[model samples]
Every structure is written in C-alpha cells, then in structure tokens.
Target: MTRFAPFLLLALVACGDNDPRYLISAPAETGTAGQVALRVATLEVRQVSLPAYAAEDEILREDETGALKPVQGALWADTPPRAMTQLLADRIAARSRAQVAAEPWPLSTPAQALVDVRVSELAARLDGQMHLTGQFAISSPDQIVRERIAPFAIAVPLAGDTPAEIARATGRALEQLAEQVIATLRR
Candidate 1:
C-alpha cells in the first residue's frame, strides 16, 4: 500500500482538474436583410443526421487521412446531430420569418414544407479550418413534382489552433450552411 501512495495521489490530482465543457450552438441570429420574401408558410425541420464519428459528444478534428480524432479534454454539451438540428431550426425560422418546428413536430397538422439535412463531415481540419459539408432535401405539400436534393460545403478559418477557436469557427460554418439552405429555399 505504501508503494502505491504516490500513484494514488497523482490520480486524485488529475481527477480534480476541471475540464471545460463547450457548447456548439447556433450563431447569433442575423437579420434577413436583402433576403427574398418567404414562399412557404410553415416549415418542419427534421433532426439532422450525422456520421458515426461526428455524432459523438467529444469535439473531433480531422486528420490528413480523413479520419477523426477527439480533441483532448474537449467535449460538446450535446451531440452533433441534435445541436445542428436546433441550429438549423432557429436559423430557418429567423431567416424566413416562418414557423419552423423541430422533430416530434408539436403541431396538430403537418407543415407546408419539410426540411431534411444530413451532415457527412463536421470537424476542424489540421489546416486550421472548421469544415461543414452536408446535403439538404426540401419537400413541399404544394409541389406537384419531386424536389431535388441540394448539397453544401462551408469552411471557416480558425482564429487559432485552440479548441475554443475551433468551436467558434464551427458555429460560423454552421451559420453559413444554414444561410445557404435558406437561400435555396427562397429560390
């Protein structure tokens, strides 16, 4: 027992260190200046789907081989899919000035339009950029024809190599992606 005292003490000290928890939230809502008037009345946003690596709670970084590695001591308050879905919902609602409901659509009736998004890549790259690449599909009850799927890729340069900077960059990338989706819907 005496020989293991130092190891035990070290373990205790390491456990006491406070690890910071970060939140990947929607970028601040921006005005719809110069945006086209909304065409759809009500929009329903489905839960954003993410790849297995991105769906993890820990923040991930992309390696050169296109693999993801979790950043040490870095974590997200929520999973990527759930967080991105909330962001998309808020952004669409604000930009289009339309009623947007998230999954489990809490309405008595179906929405006029439905938005489905899938994020295949969402991580900070070794080159110091936050990347967000995904595809979105829009379906409307009013459209007689089937809608085509739209794909988008967004990258925002990181202020630094720190995890906090990565989080901010990720938020910016998400906002840009949301803006693109809103634009496509307007068109």
Candidate 2:
C-alpha cells in the first residue's frame, strides 16, 4: 500500500503540469502598405527542414556555452517545422501574386517554382536576442533558371525579458526570413 500511495501521488502531480503553448509564426503581409509587387506566378513551399533541437515543440533558449534549455511552462502550439512552413507560405502568398501551397502541391497545374528551406538556428539566446539562420534553395520546373542555395541569417532584438517578448522576437525573425526568401526568388 505504501508503494501504491507514492505512485498515485506522482501521477497526480504529473497531471497538474499544464503549460501554455506558444505559437511561432510570422505576421501576414496582407496590407499593401509595404508589400512588394508580385514577382512569381506560382510557388510551392516545401516542408521546412530543421535541426533536431529546433524541431521540438518546446521553446528553446541557448546559453553562452551553446547549451539548449527548454523554456519552462512554455511550448509551441505545433512542431516548429510545420508552423514555420505554413507561416512562410502565408507570408509569401500575401507579398506576391503567387499561389503558394505546402507540400504535395494541391493544384491541378504544377508549380512554377519550388522553395526549400533548411533551418539551422531558431531560438532565443540568453542575451535576449532571437536569431534565425538557415539556407534556402529555389528550383524551377523548366531549365530556364539554375537552382542555387542561399544562406540567410536574421536577428531580432527582444523588447523585454519575457516569454512573450521572445515569441515576438521570433516572429520578427520569421518575417525577415520570409522577406529574404521572396527577394531571393525574385533575383
């Protein structure tokens, strides 16, 4: 009975850990205030590939020694890769006239360009700065354009030392990432 009592108590304590889930996404560029003109007709954004640590659902912070520490009581609403992919699709679609679709292109007609992103760093640092670094490649169906991979890095300053601030900084980094992708596609 003593052993059973300990197990029950542990289970009850575990059930009480309900942490809030945070979502990582870039804001839509829906407004025409600062939108760049449409450059591509159709674009397919493939599933974003991320490193093992960054792919986790938890909000991770990097220390000076390069150790990853999960933010207590905070998690991502969805896997980082999926969230990032959808966010990129939305941002690209809004900024351009291209019909953006995620993996397994849903349209009857094929996409004109395919965008692939590989994220290496996507986390907030102990110093209150969020950084995003990755390489992306754009490929066209036709042989008219040659495919090339470009590296991009963006850092956003946090407004305060809070989880919400970290999330906002992450959003800003994502926004910059989307802009870089769009610019690269145009070039």
Candidate 3:
C-alpha cells in the first residue's frame, strides 16, 4: 500500500493535470446567443501573477484574513497558468463541440465568439490545499460582451493524496469550467 500510497490518496481526487478544471462562470441568467462559437486555438499566458511568488512545492502559508500566506507547497508545476489554460481549452473544445486550434484566432473583421482566459489565482496552501482559477471574457475589439470567474479549490488530504493526484483534480476543475464556458458562449 505504501508503494501506491501516493496515488491511492489524493486531494480532490481527479483524472489528469495538477491544475483544477474550472470556468469563471457567468450568472445563469446570461447567455451569448447569436455568437458563433469559433475555436480557441491558442492561449497566450501573460504574467498576470508572478510564478516565483507561487512556486510549486512551496507551501502557501497565508496570513490571516485569507491573504496568500507566506511559504510553499510540497510540489510545484513549471508553469501553472500555462498548463491550466491548455487544459481548459481542451475541455472547452470537447464539451462545446468547438474546434480547438493550437494557434490564435485569425485577425479578421470579427470572430464569432472570442474567449480570453485570465488566471485570477492558482496556488497551493501550506496546510495542503490546491486552488486554480481563470476569468473568461467574450468580447470584440469594440465591445466587451461577457465575463465570469472560474475558480476551483480542494483540500489536500493527508490520506489518499499526492502531488499527482492534486494535479489531476486541478485539471478536472479547469476542464469542467472550460466546458461550461464553451457551452454558454456557444449558446
């Protein structure tokens, strides 16, 4: 059991990736109809937040008031936001039946629906918890169409938890979120 202990015990037990599959969700009342759901071919991961600040394996010991506690987690990912954006794109593609390309949308008059995902937060707690988030915006050059927050969080349990396990949980949350966003945008 010890050999497989890491795999057996996982926080937010999931299938793939360390980042949560999440979709910054718009309120149920909102919908982007008349919008042709095009492919989210690429995601340029801009540094909204510094990576060195949230290194993998560095336990995130937050100060009181829910601030990001100083410290690090047990493990880390080379590029958390990048990994998550890709994972989310994949999920959104699968769920919304939208074609996902590796390249960005072709610059033209306007895209049917343009999706931009921004990581609002991605980190692990010193106490052992994982969080992944993204904000989605459907917009055009002239107008801002819609927006929402895709945040996922789960505890890193002492038992049945490993770095890999949490990673998968993270991925799952992102995937689900992306799928949801795609659905709304496509609708």
TM-score of each: 0.81, 0.83, 0.48
- The models' CA-based lDDT, in order, is 0.78, 0.80, 0.46
Q: Candidate 1: which stretches are off by over 4 Å?
A: 1-18, 30-36, 63-67, 142-146
Best by lDDT: 2
lDDT of 2: 0.80
* Cα deviation of 96, candidate 3, in Å: 2.0
After TM-score superposition, the amount by which residue 138's alpha carbon in candidate 1 deviates from its true location, in angstroms, is 0.4
Model 2, 80-102: lDDT tens digits are: 78888888888887776568888
Q: Sort by TM-score, best first: what order?
A: 2, 1, 3
- The C-alpha local distance difference test score for the whole of candidate 3 amounts to 0.46
Residue 180, model 1, lDDT: 79
**lDDT of each residue in 39-70, candidate 1, tens digit only:** 67677889988888888877778767977878
Question: On lDDT, who's better, 1 or 3?
Answer: 1
